[model samples]
Structure formats: C-alpha cells, structure tokens
Target chain A: MPDVIQIKAFGMIAEAIGSDSLEIENPGTSLALKKQLEAQFPGLKSMKFSLAVDKKMIQEDTDISQGKEIALLPPFSGG
Target chain B: MDRFERQVILPGFGPEGQGKLKQSSVLVIGAGGLGCPVLLYLAAAGVGKIGVVDGDVVSLSNLNRQVLFGEKDLRKNKAETAVRYFQDKYSDIQWEIFPEFITVENAQELILGYDLVIDGSDNFPTRYLVNDACVLMEKPLVFGAIYQHEGQVSVFNHGPNSCNYRDLYPQMPSAKEIPNCSETGVLGVLPGIIGNLMALESIKVLSGFGKPLKNKVLFFNSLTSQTYEVEISANSDSKSSIPETWKDFEQMDYELACEGIKQLSWNEAMKLMGHDVAFVDVREPGELPPLECTGLMKVPFSTLSSQLDRFEDAEEVLFFCQSGIRSQKAAQQLQQVYPDKKIFSIRGGINALKS
Candidate 1:
C-alpha cells in the first residue's frame, strides 16, 4: 500500500498536467515523484519549472512519502 | 507633527532612514498592476526621486487592480497618469517619467541613471532583459510577477552572490509557453500584495533597516493563503550569458528569443479542411458554436498529450482554442512531438471563425 499524494499544478504547468491537481500514488522522494510525473508527462519533462513540496522549494531529493501537497510552480511572466 | 511624522516614529526607521530614502532614486518599469503599488508606496515613503517607465494606457480592465487610475483616467498614458497622481499627493519628491516601453535601444540609458531598478514587467523577454541589464549595470533590481492567484517577489543583483532572474531560470521559455495576464487572467489583489512586498524590499535596501529578499524568491498563493520562500543559489556562470560587449547586447535577439508558435487564419484553416490534416478543437467539450469541418475533432490542449493516438491518421494538425492563445500552446507542443509535420494554431481561434 502506498500513500496518495495531491500534486497541485500552477500556471503553464497546470496546462501541461490538464488538471489543477491530481492524486497519484506516492512515489517516495521528491526526485522520484518528479520522475513519475515526467514519465506520465513527457512535455513536462522538458518544461522549465520547479517543484515545491509542503510549500518549500526542494533543491535536494527530499522525501515525500507522507502524501503532502506538491506544487508545480512554473516561472510566472505576468505582473 | 510633520507630514512624515507617522512613519518616522518607528525606532529602526528614524529620521536618518527617512533621510536616506529622501536621497535615493528608484526606477520602476511597467506601470500596470505591480508598478502602481510599488510607485505609490515608494512615493509615500518619500523616496527622493522615482522614475516611471511604461507605454501602456489605462483601460476599463485596469481599474480592477491599477488603483492609480479611475474610470475618468481611462485611455490616459500610465506613466503620465502615475506621475500626475504621485506629484499631486507628494510634492516633495521629483517624479521622472518615460512614456515609452523600455527596449534594448533605450533600456540602458533609463536603467543606469537610477540607483535601484524595480521590475514590474509583464513578459519573459523584458524580465530576462531587465535581469541582464541589472547584472551588467550592477543595479539592484526588485522583481515581482503575478499569475492567476499566485505571485513571486525577489530581489536581484543587490548584493554579492545574489541570484538574478536568469540565475534562478537561465533561459527564457517560448512566448507560447507563457500565459500573460490578458491570456490567462490574474487576480486583482495578487499584484498588489506582491508589489507592496517589492516596495518593502526597495525601502529595506534603500534605508538599510532590514534584510532585503536578496537571494530568496517569495511565492504566494491567495486561495490557499500559503507562502513559500525559495532560496535561489547564485550561479556564477549565469552572468556569462549576459552580453559582455555593448555591441553584443545591442544585437541580442529578444523577439526571436521569445518567439511564439505559427498562427493560421480562418481562411488558411478552411483551405486545409479537405486535406488529410487533424483540425483540433483545443477548447473544452461543449464550448458553444460548433465548428463544422470535414475532419474536425475535439482534443483539448490539456488532454491532447494523453490522446495523441486519436490523431495518428493525420500527417498534420491545426489547433484552435476559444481565443487562440491555448491553441498556440497546443501547436507548439505538437510541433515538438512531430517536428517534420506541419502544425499551426488558428488565429483568433473559433471566435475569428464566427466573424
């Protein structure tokens, strides 16, 4: 049994993901989740954006097995 | 008992801080949503001189967030309007106005004169250009951006090892990838919130009261009421991308750098109707006014990637959204998938088809 994570997308990332948020089986660490998402969305793989878990931008492969809120923040060009 | 008595009472922000603010000059780019508040707060703070650079006009839609203008000021130039408003309220400070867009031709002159540059620009090319200019000129830039319900605030080029916009994200994405305010729409209060933060950073940097958001990017989500502070590490190599020579900087291809996907008019789309091409309706299902064509099919841009197999029969594809913005994004994505195939987005989308 795996924890279900709610991956919330923003701006263009939402357009890439189709839905604002998707519940997916927790793939473990932040890096693993990104790999899972990239595999599901090839377009997302090449897209230049950052992933934030629990409202913090992750630079390292932090763990996310608790199924917390993950936000895909694309660079906002609007003001 | 004076006009500035209220704010001067704060311990850390005393008469000396006020004096520093009264002696500093700040240049604000883009007098739209973010610029309005940044200008207003910096003006009220009694900054010695403030330069406003914008070529946009006040329209009915701007009233929702650009608080400087009222219904009466509609159609007036934003730079001119802002100068008038600030000069009227705070006559102590000098309001410098540049009633034109900051391009590669004029940006250097406009930016270098001011001690601090506050970027409220609305597009990626301008944003990156500003960052490059700030890096080259060694001017501190207070940056802000807004999306639907979220906003980002950062201080770039202000201190040693400080991360500029390019340091965070090195290259500019295609224009089709970014959704401007006109295309995706932004919350009225989001820019205000972020602009105020920008102003706060400017004051902090000017007065030396507190630490500015030098290398950190602040992200805010209005709906969730959540705030995230992302620490951006300075990439020493990022500065290398900025043109070393004036000639190189002048030759930078910003327009081609921010190029959009190819667009097709209704006539062109109609011409391709009889051919073996996939006419994609990127709009969500049940969108009004059905598109009657020989090979029209519904494949919303969002779900299009998942259902690419549906369009396997066609050698080419043409995507159309409600207003043409999303379709451009769809076509750009498909173009990457099938680089050899001809892919286009219908100009003005189905709305143009109606007319």
Candidate 2:
C-alpha cells in the first residue's frame, strides 16, 4: 500500500475545506494529487491554492511520498 | 537596571542581540497605522539604525491610530515626524528619513542596504513590489496588516525555511476590489497589535530567539479576542520565472491583474437591492452581525468558489466580507469563471453597507 500523504490548508483555504488536513494515498505527482483532491472535494475548484510538498514549496512536477505533509495554501490575506 | 534590562538578560540577545540591533539597519515602508507602531517599537527597542520611508504628511484623522504623531505634527512629512519623534526619545539610535514613497524603480535599491524590511504598506502593488524585491535581495521581511478588528502578522525570507509573501498570496486582488485604510476605517489598536507583532518577529529573526513564525502566519481577531496560527508553505504555481524585461515588472500592475470584476460603492449597491442584484456575504458562517440585506444570501467566503453555480440564475451578483477584501477576491474569481455574469464588490464591504 502506498503511504498516505497529509495535506493542510490555511487561512482562506482552511475556511473553505472546513477542515485543516486532507489525507490521501501518495499520488505520483503533485498535479495528479491535486486533481484527485479536487475530484474528491469539488469545492476545491474555485480555490486558488498552491501545493507545498513536505515543508518547502515545490515548483516542478514532483512526486509525493508517504508520510509527507502537503499544504494547499490559498492567497493569505493576513499581513 | 534599565528599561531594556530584562530583554538584555536573555541568551544570545544578551550582548550580541543588543549590539546587532544597535548596528543593524531596518527600512520601514509606510508611516501610517502599522508603520507608527513598528517605528515606535523598533526605536524603543534600541535598533541602532532605522530608516523611515513614506511620502504622506501627517493628517488630523491619522491621530486615532498613528500614535507616533500628533495634531502639532500635522502637515509634516510622516518620515520627518517619525525621525524627530524617535530622535527625541532615543538619541542613541541612528535614523534616516526618506520623505518619498517607495516606487518600483527605487524599491530595489532603497531596500538593498537594509538588513530587514517591514511592510506597513496598504496597497497590493506596493506590497507585491516590496515582497519581490526583498525576495531578490534575500532579505527577511516582517509583514503586518489590519482590516477592521482583525490583523495578520508574518515573517518572510529569513532563512532557507523562509517563505516569501508570494508564497502566501500568489495573486493580487484587483484595485477595484480592495480598499485602502482610508476607505475602510481601521480600529485604532488593530495596526498597533500587528505592528508590534512585526517588531517581535523581526527581533526574533535578528537575535535567533524562540521559534520565529518563519513560514507561518499569525492571525488576531480583536472582535472575538481569539488567535489562530496557520503554517504557510511554498506554492508551485508562483511565477518563479522572473521576467527578462524591466518593463515587465512595471507593467505588471496588480490593480489590473485580476480583471472582469466590477466594483460598487455601498450607496450604489444599496440602490440595486430591490432589483435583480443578489447580495452574497462571503464571511464565515458564524461571522458576527450577519449582513442585513433584503435580498442577501450568506455563502461564507470560503465556499463561494465551489458554490458558484448556486447563483446561476442571478443576472448580477455582489460580493462582500467584513471589510470587502475577501469579497473583492471572490468577485475576481467569479469573473474568471463566469465571464457573462456581472460580478461586483461592495467597497468597504459590510462596514459600508450601513453607510
């Protein structure tokens, strides 16, 4: 079984998801995982969030591993 | 035994922190509410070198929150008044006053010499410009902002773990969607709270103290007196591809970034209440003082994007939040998806609803 990746959303995104973290099987790539998450949570389509693998921001099409924490960050309005 | 004696006794910051602060240089943008507390605390904390950047002159209305200046200081440049005030109180610290607003052309060079940048700027363009420049220079930024009774504070670009402001807010809301502090009145202590937090974070970064909120956002709600902490992670979609042309940066006007959204003043929106215009309150479900409109609907800001289809039949839609910032962003998103639908933001949000 593939390791489950945990993703967290903050600020506006957190308020949208209505929860903090979303756990799912580690999809091969960040884009794939995003699509899967969006499919699961239809509300995610309207949100403009960036994917962060582990703690740092991943710009390239990177793969997600087991136990890694991913964050779906919305545009932070906080100063 | 001195007023700063307690702080001086802390580890790392004991003698070195004091010396670094005295020798360190900081450039603060804006001399308004946020800048006022930031400047005051930085000077009070004995930062050796301080620079004040702002072109606006002190005004009578600023007295409510801009505690650094008074009626007598009105008509004087904010930077000049701040310098004078700091000099009188802390003669030991060095001060530089820039009586001009930070522009894209000067933002980079002006921010280069400073060890840290504090963004008290109110507009989206200035904030983005500052963040981009700071990221390019690899300088840490202590950011603070206030809307109504709530405030946000964060530290960006301190170290390898640092995240730039863009990491949090990748896109800038259109100017038509957002309002300046002047447009939306801020609570007097809101900026003070956030500004002091900026100072605290800066000190932590400078002195290497307790875990700084590097890559994390701290939120304060004065209305409910509650605090929420959120961890910020880097985003993949950010335009890491820096443009090759200087004109590109200049032309990248944040005001025009998110288009297709219309803006309506409170009065203008009120006039359409009985018409086909639909009002959507995008605040949280439990957000206080539910918007009181005859034809208004509540769809918390977070859910508006996913629930866009709910208003399919509406000829026009109006978005609003506590202070209009979130609503403006919502309208921008709505415009992106529903090009045919006329989406508008209520300037000053619910605060203006009454007016």
- Native-referenced TM-scores of chain A, all candidate models: 0.88, 0.81
Clashing pairs in 2: B22-B48, B282-B301
> What's the DockQ for every one of the candidates?
0.39, 0.20
Candidate 1 residues A1-79, lDDT tens each?
Answer: 5678888887667777898789998888888888888898887876777777766666557888676988787898887
lDDT of 1 by residue, B1-355 (tens): 7678887999999999999999999999999999999998998889999999987667687888898999998767789998998777877998889987676778889987788999998877778878888888889999999878888888999867777887777657766666678777777888899999999999999999998988888878888887777677655667788888666787875644665455666777778765678888888878766776655788877798898677666788888987566887777777677777777777657655544
DockQ of 2: 0.20
Worst 10 residues of 1 chain B by lDDT: B253-262
**Highest TM-score among the candidates is held by which one?**
1
Question: How do the predictions measure up, each by TM-score?
Answer: 0.73, 0.63
For candidate 2, lDDT tens digit of each residue in B170-209? 6565344334566567778878888888888877777676
Model 1 accuracy (lDDT, Cα): 0.81
Which candidate number would show the highest lDDT if scored against the true structure?
Answer: 1
